[model samples]
Target: MVSISNSVKTGITTGTLRRVHHIALNVQDMQASRHFYGTILGLHELKGEEVPKTLIELVAAGKVANFVTPDGTVIDLFGEPELAPPDPDPKRGFTRANHLAFDIAPELFEQAVEVLRENQILIDHGPVTRPTGRGIYFYDPDGFMIEIRCDPMD
Candidate 1:
């Protein structure tokens, strides 16, 4: 055989990483989390397969959502049996590095909050106006704060 290393080098080519494939998260209740993400947030559901320990994938806006991002990355929602929300320290207030955010239509801010309140989800803050647009903060069943807003400021 002629120069195996040379042949390998010729075969290799440069490529660029596009974007994220998925995001894995441990949730308290798989069904509830699914409903919240799938129904409320409107993330499209895939096959709904259960693979024991492996993570589940909920495609954001499903296959047709490819046009949403330049790299065509889909958001994947995961469910873990042990992933419960941390206990809150009343004195410290609700604070943590873990959170998810979504941008809402500027005019629909109040409607969004009403929807959350109807679901009995706690409203942590206001859909009040900031310099950018209206924003509101709330917690999921797992105590993970979810921010819904329009025109978020840098």
Candidate 2:
């Protein structure tokens, strides 16, 4: 049997990376996509600026999409829709693996559902239980799957 040193045992810390800085996603239309994330999702528009001929960036801050429960996170919406992979099988429905997962406070589930329904957006699944806990799946205007989840352990 091999023995490990105390220093080696202490090296592995129980922690995660501080927080997600930003998630960049390609959208068919920058303006409409920004509206979906900012207006519909209730994320505040932090910045929406164009950078020359290359791309446009739309940043937002909010809770449902935040790094902290109420501290807000930065979501960078990119303008180059052509950059994302094309769905080879359009008839197969949304098969792209690219997505963003967000942590939603348990209390906000109802408001989230109402907001989504009011926006005429279709939900893929429910505020039901996973091993992780209750969650809901939905899509953005750009067909990017977004998940609102609550960790059971939390």
Candidate 3:
């Protein structure tokens, strides 16, 4: 008879899974979104290209742009023409109900906040502290919420 260890039984293996590679977002204005993410957030633009014909026909997005964060996280922005932005859900209100969060160093958290303030970005919520970390929330150019958070030991 063969016996399997608990680690193997649970499918736990070292270095089997890597970090997130990218996140894609649909936007209304490619240039405005590009400036907010690439210029203001300090992410580097990799390249620009048209979205696949099938995707453009289906989703109405004609062009796409890619950017990378300092930590190698990728952000893909999609822009569609002639499509009106969806009306806000009454229950969720006007802004985004969900958000993307980025991890930051504790020391850099304050500097990040100052950078946003200097750019005239409004904070939607936080600078609040929790047991796990401190965080702040703000809205992107397209009304999507974003968070920057820091843990003391991280």
Candidate 4:
């Protein structure tokens, strides 16, 4: 058997890396992606000059779109021509669990669902139950799978 250690002797301490600081994604359109994540998803968009200093280089001097979740998770969307589009087949849907999951407050779950409906966004899988919580799945305009999980199911 093999064992791994991080007690400083093996190099990095447990605090070496904190929680996920950000997630970068490639998208089809800057404006649409910004609208979806900023407006529909209700994340705060970091408009010009408001983008974080540390992210400037990677953000490509206003070329990328930046949004922040209420919990401070940063989302960076890069608008580039697609190398390939999301699979259009049901059998390839799960595709080995390729998806991004976001958390929503249980109290606001119904409102969120309503918002999705109002926007005419299709719900691919849920509002389904699990021992852990209730979740809804869908796809972003670029075909990335997205999951919204509302815990403490009533």
The candidate that wins on lDDT is 4
Report the alpha-carbon TM-score of model 2 versus the true structure.
Answer: 0.62
Best-performing candidate as measured by TM-score: 4
Clashing pairs in 4: none
Per-residue C-alpha lDDT of model 2 across residues 55-80, encoded as one tens digit per residue: 23213322112111245556656566
Each model's lDDT comes to: 0.58, 0.61, 0.75, 0.78
Error of 1 at 45 (Å): 1.6
How far residue 82's Cα lies from its native spot in candidate 4, in Å, is 3.8
Off by over 4 Å in 4: 1-11, 54-62, 89-97
Candidate 3 per-residue lDDT over residues 10-108, each given as its tens digit: 665888779877788877788888888887788787743433343444334437777777788778887865534465432243544478888889999
Looking at candidate 2, what is the lDDT of residue 93? 51
Q: Report the C-alpha lDDT of model 1 over 1-154, residue by residue, as the tens digit.
A: 5555644545434565455565455565666776777667665554434221233323322211111112333444455666534555322234445466777666677788888888887777786787878788887656777788897444
Error of 2 at 103 (Å): 1.7
Cα lDDT of candidate 2 equals: 0.61
Clash pairs (backbone) in predicted model 2: none
- 36-123: candidate 4 lDDT, tens digit per residue: 8988898898865978887777567546889988888888898785535566553256344588888988988778888888998767
Better of 2 and 3 by TM-score: 3
Q: By summed lDDT, which 10 consecutive residues of candidate 2 come out lowest?
A: 60-69
Candidate 1 Cα errors over 4 Å, as ranges: 1-20, 48-73, 88-98, 152-154
- Candidate number that wins on lDDT, 1 or 3: 3
For TM-score, candidate 1 versus 2, the one ahead is 2
